[model samples]
Target: MDAKEKPETTSSMPQRRPDCIKCFDALWFCYSPFHQMQNYYRYGEFDNCFGKWGDLVDCLALKTKRAAEAEEILIAREKAKPHIWTFRTVDEASENWWRMYKHLVLMSPPLPGAAQPPPRSDKS
Candidate 1:
């Protein structure tokens, strides 16, 4: 085809398919209309069933990962608390404490974007 006649391509090309088995499994679980419709009522959207499910699954997976990361950070902070010097002022520590607590609460399981737990590796 002539350069002038070549099809115009945009930067918003579709993404490549995910290779992770967990992601695929999550996607499969989301494909059914029964599930999608229930989720639609619980969440939102209707017409784009499969796409919506895929998006939900992906979001869940990311949320799970982030939650896990946040938990680890919390643990590390707790472990280092003794050695780490804190603010001498009560208000400073109180503010920091509340911020950390809020983050932990937000990271807890079932939080929005929290992914369903992956299947146990021991299961056959």
Candidate 2:
């Protein structure tokens, strides 16, 4: 055998995943439709993949060692978001926008400390 014909070995091959990305990819795959459907057909429900989720969480927490703190912070941030912050259809979103800022809409009081504009004319 010649040098050009040398066989490749595991040590010389590139790794499928060399970082935390592997854990993330595995977690995503666990949540994919194909995997979930297969699991559902066999087990009547999706695979929880809690171990994969834990692996990714652990991998990320390795950097700051603050997994619990991070989860709390995320939950707090979610709770602090405005009602309009969530995604909705155009009609649904545009409707009832006033509910989010009812305080700002002084319909009854009608323009405090400011003069009312001139009324519209039919001419134009």
User: Whose TM-score is greatest here?
Assistant: 2
Backbone steric clashes in candidate 2, count? 0
Off by over 4 Å in 1: 1-19, 47-124
Q: In order, what is each prediction's RMSD in angstroms? A: 21.2, 18.6
Model 1: what TM-score? Answer: 0.24
Residue 6 Cα positional deviation in candidate 1, in Å, after optimal superposition = 58
User: Candidate 2 at residue 89, lDDT?
Assistant: 84
lDDT of each: 0.59, 0.69
Determine the C-alpha RMSD for candidate 2 after optimal superposition of all C-alphas.
18.6
List of clashing residue pairs for candidate 1: 60-115
lDDT of 1 by residue, 1-124 (tens): 7778977656455323334566656666676787778878987875454664665565455455655464565466558777655445775565556556756655675667854443335624
The C-alpha TM-scores of every prediction are 0.24, 0.35
As a whole number from 0 to 100, the lDDT of residue 76 in candidate 1 is: 65
Tens digit of per-residue lDDT, candidate 2, span 75-100: 66657989785788864564446446
